[model samples]
Target: MSTVYDCSRPQERKDGLAAAASAVRSGQLVVIPTDTVYGIGSDAFSLSAVHSLLAAKGRGPDMPVGVLVGSWSTIDGLVLSVPYQARQLIEAFWPGDLSIVLRHAPSLAWDLGHTKGTVMVRMPLHPVAIELLRETGPMAVSSANRSGQPPASTVDEAREQLGDSVRVYLDGGPSGDPVPSTIVDLTGDEPILLREGAVSIEAVSEALGGVQVGRPR
Candidate 1:
């Protein structure tokens, strides 16, 4: 059985965050509301937890998972090096809707599956998500839905898809628009646009001082 918390209530919000953090630490899955859509998340450094998250979504490990951080400073410890362009982009759109891919630090002992020594990370703007992340550290999060299904914009929709697989569902109400964060790859010398979602390519270029972003191949 899973617990659903209506975060509109103060007490429930507090309880939910506690339960969700506990679940993550115990290697369980949790559903959280992000700025764009609901996400199914687990402890990023826990290999078993990441596997469970992927299993719940009927997703393959080859696709990999993205990690969500609580703040900008949290990113410094995860990546091998934060390039100048990455810093500029983060300053321009962090805590909003931008995901950046960079080489992961070799010292870390986590497996997100087939990431090829890289990790996609972002800091979401949603309060519930940020609070949970701050308490639990980085989390491997993917859209709250089964494979081949539409992303869940509401907690109800997330529960319908993930069901008992998720230990806790933090309801932050309807996530307007359901647009995903734009993904930029900073592993190479230049920035590459892997996917364009909420943030536009034009906006990204402007943030990087007119540097051309390689279009999605």
Candidate 2:
């Protein structure tokens, strides 16, 4: 049976976080809460763990997953370049609802689905998620649900979808926002809005010094 952790208590939260981190270190999948939704995550550097997470979600390798980091400094090491505009956006909206896609560092070893030379990255605002990331380093995380299902916003929802496939479910109460993060592509000259969720285009444009918002090509 999967280990379900109640994060409401401080001691339980720390214990759960430690167990989840240990799972990730051992290449096991753990479902943790994020600012946007529950995410099923594994160590970003573990190829086997990445594959396991995809299989657990019934997700194809072509659907890329987002890499969750605890801080902005971690972002620099993972992606090739954080553009000036992207940096501004990170400064303004990060640890909140923004996710940026950039060219992946060539030396990185794991495959996050079909991302070839690119990576989707975010620093989630939720304290539990951040604590887990800080402990496990970086996690290859995607919304906790079956491939085509709506993302789970609560631990119960994640349990219903993932169940025993996931080793641990960190319950940090229902996510503050049911909507997913606003995904922006920063690899190109003009910012491309991939998925509109929490962050609005106007906010992103203002952060990038009035750069025109364009649809993802």
Candidate 3:
């Protein structure tokens, strides 16, 4: 059985966060809560850990995972560039349900199952997740559920699906939304909507000054 942490209690939350950080450092997978849904994550810099996370989810390499960052400046360290429009979107909707995909910095040595040298990134809207990210630096995260299955909304659901595959599960109650983040590919001249979730197309388009393009369903 996985080591589950009750985030509702103050002491347990701290202990759980510490344990989760240690697990990531030791190249183990962790299941944590995000703004949109429960997520399974691992240290973004750990190639073996990232691979383990993917294996746990039975996910394909083509379906890239998103990295959760604690702050805006951290974004520059990971992605090659953050466009002006993209920055606006981040400023407006970040710490919420907006995820941006950008060209990965060739200098960084990490595997996140991305193709064409790009990676999806987000700063989740949950305080617990932010606190954990602040400690772990950055985490490669995907919804805590099997590929093609409905995303896990509660910690119990995540436990049911992920079980012992993950070393720790930070129980932050249910997620803010059952849907995933609105994924926007900001690598190109025009922003492309990869997946529509909490943020609407019109809002994203306006944030990008009318340059939003929706991805094909």
Candidate 4:
């Protein structure tokens, strides 16, 4: 059975977060609440763990997993480059709900399920989620639910879908926002808005001095 931790208590929150981080380091999955929604995360560098995460989510290889990082250095280590324009966007709405897809650093060995030499990275604004990410370095995170299922708005909702598949559940109450992160692909010369969610298309375009928004694939 998964150990569900109530983050309402200060001490329990710390202990639970520590255990969650440990789980990620040991190749175990954990359901964490982010600013946008609840996400199931595994160690980004663990190839096997990433595969397990995909299986748990019933996700296919063609669908890439987005990455959650604690800071810019972690982002730099994972991606080929963070363009100045992209950096502007990152600065403008990071730790919130904007995900930027960048060219993956070839030397960094990690599989996020057919990312096609690119990675979608985000810095979420949730305290518990960011704390866990900082402790775990980086994690391959996907919304907490089976593929095509509505995202879990609360920890219990996530627990219902993930259950024993997850080692720990950090309950941070309602996600507050059911909207997913705005995904902007900056791997090419032009920034492409792959999906619009919490961050609007106009905001992204303005941050990059104007860019194209594409229909979701």
- Measured against the true structure, the TM-scores of the candidates, in listed sequence, are 0.99, 0.97, 0.95, 0.96
Task: lDDT for model 2, please.
Answer: 0.90
Q: Name the lDDT of candidate 4.
A: 0.88
21-77, model 3: which lDDT tens digit per residue? 999899999998888899999999998989988998888777777799989889988
Computed on alpha carbons, the lDDT of every model, listed in order, comes to: 0.96, 0.90, 0.87, 0.88
**CA error at residue 91 for candidate 4, angstroms:** 0.9
Give me the candidate number with maximum TM-score. Answer: 1
Model 4 — which ten-residue stretch has the worst lDDT? 208-217
lDDT of 2 by residue, 1-217 (tens): 7898899998899889989998999999999988888899999999999999999899789898889999989998998877888789889998989999999989888888788789998999989999889888989999999988988989999999988988888998888657989999888778899988899999999888888889965
Worst 10 residues of 2 by lDDT: 172-181
State in Å the error of residue 145, model 1.
Answer: 0.2
User: What order do you get sorting by TM-score, best first?
Assistant: 1, 2, 4, 3
Q: Could you tally the backbone clashes for each prediction?
A: 0, 0, 1, 0
RMSD of 2: 1.0
State the lDDT at 100 in candidate 1: 98
* Residue-pair clashes, model 1: 0
- Residue 207 in candidate 2, Cα distance off native in Å: 0.7
In model 3, what lDDT does residue 138 have?
Answer: 92
Q: What is the C-alpha RMSD of each candidate to the true structure, in Å?
A: 0.7, 1.0, 1.5, 1.4
Query: Candidate 1, after superposition: displacement of residue 172 in Å?
Result: 0.2
Instruction: For candidate 3, give the lDDT of residue 74.
Output: 90
Q: What are the per-residue Cα lDDT tens digits for candidate 4 across 1-217?
A: 6898889899999999989988999999999999988999999999999999999999887897989998766888887877897789878987789998989899988999888899999999988998888899989999999888899999999988888999999999998859999988877656778888998999887777776666555
Report the candidate with higher TM-score, 3 versus 4: 4
